[model samples]
Target: MTSSVLEAQKLGRKYGRRWALRDCTIEIPSGHVVGLVGPNGAGKTTLLKLASGQLEATEGAVTVLGDRPAATPARLARIGFVAQDTPVYSGLSIADHLRLGARLNPRWDAAMAQERIARLGLAPDQRAGKLSGGQRAQVALTLGLAKRPELLILDEPVAALDPLARREFMQGLMEATVEHEFSVVLSSHLVSDLERVCDFLVVLVDSRVQVAGETDKLLATHYRLTGPRRDTDRLPADQQVISASHTDRQSTFVVRTDSPIHDPAWTVTQLNLEDLVLAYMDKHTADRRAALEVQR
Candidate 1:
């Protein structure tokens, strides 16, 4: 089994009266590509910032590589972060960024950085402000990779890129992971992109972690059951219902269980990653509705 590269316990972050993230607990295993999936305003950026030590948690704790985040120089050196905007010095050239990276990081991979820039066809002397969106993103990614951290955290890194650039970036990221044997935690609401590059998955909704586990295991265990309208209480306790919908004549439930389902009264169908994620999101929506009803 893979050891956890990043762990959070009851983690939370608040902005004034609003909670950006709350009761968020997750474990990202070492040496695997993990995907953080959530809609806008889902606290995905907040969680990533916490891991990168850019933002302090309002409560609970977060650890990266077995040490508290931002606790020591060594701890900080072990993580690489590329923010959602992929910030770069607009006035600086690509070579200038490499020079700055070498000065700041003890383990900077100068050769690797140079090779990647060459491969991307980015001119070493060309200013960052002059590059296209995709080119700029590539430069930012190169800088992150060259730092040679044990864990790399990316926040919606491809959201602004064209489809082709996104594919190339993902391909490069995968290759780098294989070559360096490092772990990654990438945030994106686009299930299609995550599906291609990540083996582990974490789904967050409404500032809380809905579910997190290995992608294959999650897909294999979750199933949809449909049949005559019936109360959920009638199903075996072993079938943990994730989401449910009902009509006068029919009922449907998304469930997770380790035991084999043999009931003839229901039709069981498997869920793709997108389907599974949406079910959890729907469950969260239902929970909010129920809370509102209780308040009335």
Candidate 2:
């Protein structure tokens, strides 16, 4: 219903002395499958938890579907979260899980749940513990989808699955999204997976958002330029370098700029989604290293 599915402003979460997420501000617009990609400990999970109301922010604020996340029963019903490892009760049968979901969620669609389970060829009597990792993930995803939430958040749902299983899980998810017409925020380390499924992208690193935008726009604006070796200071100010490397005879830089590069000395090429995300991530790491060196 809102223009944005998830909105955060200076959002941060601290665990005693350590900050899991800091100064993360992003507005994920509605009707898009957003990919949240970053390396380990980049605060992707922390941000997802805050959005799903599993954890409170230590600073700033976050809103989901135009209201404070999970502020009330009604609001909670509108947002579904499938956490890492696709958690499920090993002792419970698939039917039991559906029953539990129905009992807890007022908007739960029992028929749809049953239908999905049958379509997946999973027996209602099958114990979650007996199911494969991929099957368990599917069961969890079914629960989330049956709730009929306006927004669904998945944190590395397929991280433990094999290649084929991971593809299957993602395919099923995309199909469900198309059918249900809900917004999604998915976090994963597999950039290639994200590239396949996500229309919008968010790159988080070192407890901060390095960049966030539509995938097409990000790829279009960011370019990889290679030319004769030169200091970054010599490049135009408009070309904000995200990451750079130099050899004795040549230099390469990833930069973000709206303007065209007409300089004859440099060769510019477009970057893929994975490259774009990595460029931002590499830039963050480089900046941190530079700061630490200065301190030393």
Candidate 3:
């Protein structure tokens, strides 16, 4: 088994004159449920597609399970991809979809699939088009899981469901992961969803990776400091400011540093996952505006 389930070195993709994803590099270790978080237009779909071999990268290289993604039939069999919106054929019944999966995948587990459907209380004769949004998503997930892939990539699978539905869907997914022991890369714009299920995180913004690491480590290294007004240039070299804001006589900053903070003038507090992700996103936005100002 490969230590890393997915690896990319400066991977990128473009269409016409616009680059959808650029200078993207990340390595997801095996046995993790990695959450890919970013706003809309962050190129999350493009990156996932590249990983699943649905689209080729215009530059750089990507490897899945120590081989090029989707390089062969056997290689493809080991990776499962569920695209955004949880698409299912409207014309096919639940049983028909399972039949299709069995025919298409060499490692299909019909009994497991049937068992999952039965547990979900879904009738085999029910048409996919007649199912609720959550039910359809479950059906799609069942198909992906039944393939028995080493790695499964899900693109915003629960984006369209209601709060209750989302929770239920995620609960099912987490349960399946524990039972199957497969690596997963799930993408979403909502932090709350990822916060509940992911151990690893990757934040993408402006078609680039803003931050990527284990969630606990990221939370530990990042701190929020509040102090009397002071210029960021005066901060210690080890402290990298991610985002900053100032009032008339006070300043607040989110900083990343491995060393302990001993400053007596500032009060430091730990940041949550949402705070850390937002700080990086804010820093990226500020930098882009600064670059635009320089051009003007």
Model number with the top lDDT: 3
What TM-score, over all chains together, does every model reach?
0.94, 0.95, 0.95
RMSD of each: 1.6, 1.6, 1.5
The residue-by-residue lDDT of candidate 3 on 16-40, one tens digit each, is 8899989888888889999999999
* Cα TM-score of candidate 2: 0.95
- Which candidate number maximizes TM-score? 3
What digit string (tens of lDDT, one per residue) describes model 2 on residues 11-105?
Answer: 99999999998998888899999999999998999999999999999999998888888657888899999999999999999999999999999
lDDT of 1 by residue, 73-187 (tens): 6776789999997889999999999999999888899999999999998899999999988888889999899999999999999999999989998998998998997899999
Q: Which order, best to worst by TM-score? A: 3, 2, 1
CA lDDT of every candidate: 0.92, 0.92, 0.93
At residue 130, candidate 2 shows an lDDT of: 98
Name the runs in model 1 displaced over 4 angstroms: none
Model 1: number of backbone collisions: 0
The alpha-carbon lDDT assigned to residue 169 of candidate 2 equals 88
